[model samples]
Target: MPNQPKTPVKGFRIPVDLYDAALAKAQSEGRTLTDVVREALHRYIDAD
Candidate 1:
């Protein structure tokens, strides 16, 4: 089988402040918004 790209999941709403902060952090670190959110969610899930 050939390598495949992952499909992105969407349609969640977040608070404006949280979105702004994440956007700012992503910009500062030169990363995509998806990358930042994915990392954050991974950390959150692993913390339990």
Candidate 2:
């Protein structure tokens, strides 16, 4: 079979509690919230 193209990734907004947790984790990790979230997502996608 031919290789299929990857679809564009979609983003969703965080709820308050999760957003706060991510912000806290980001601060403690010395990273920006965006970086923290991106890193988390990268891990999630790579897990499988």
Candidate 3:
């Protein structure tokens, strides 16, 4: 099957403390900040 095009990228500002915390956790876990945030958002939405 052909690959689908990815969604366009978007940017938003977050608090410095939140970014720092996500960066630290991502580094420790060997993952990107995007990965951490995506997982977090998925869990949050699924909790509804």
Candidate 4:
């Protein structure tokens, strides 16, 4: 996706617990939080 932002997105607000969970999941998978979140959002959008 060449159109993806070159920098990390900032200032988005989500629950601390949710953030922690996503962080842990990303770490355990050896991936970035952004990658994890992006995949999640993709899945969610495609789910319907």
Arranged by TM-score with the best first, the candidates are 3, 1, 4, 2
For each candidate in turn, the TM-score is 0.67, 0.58, 0.72, 0.65
Question: What lDDT does the true structure give each of the candidates?
Answer: 0.86, 0.79, 0.87, 0.86
Looking at model 4, residue 12 earns an lDDT score of 84
lDDT (tens digit, per residue) of candidate 3 on 8-36:
78899999998999899899999888778
| lDDT tens digits by residue: candidate 1, 7-36 | 667879999999999899899999989887
Give the per-residue lDDT digits (tens) of candidate 2, residues 1-48.
149576566778769998898789889988888667677889999999
**Cα lDDT tens digits for candidate 4, 1-48:** 569669855778999999999899889999989878788889999999
* Model 3: worst 10 consecutive residues (lDDT sum): 1-10
List per-candidate RMSD values in Å.
3.8, 8.0, 3.4, 3.3
Q: Residue 39 CA error for candidate 3 (Å)?
A: 0.5
- Models sorted by lDDT, best on top: 3, 4, 1, 2
Q: Residue 32's C-alpha lDDT in candidate 1?
A: 83
Between which residue pairs do clashes occur in model 3? none
Worst 10 residues of 4 by lDDT: 1-10
Residue 6's lDDT in candidate 4: 90
Clash number by candidate, in order: 0, 0, 0, 0
Task: Flag regions of model 2 displaced more than 4 Å.
Answer: 1-11
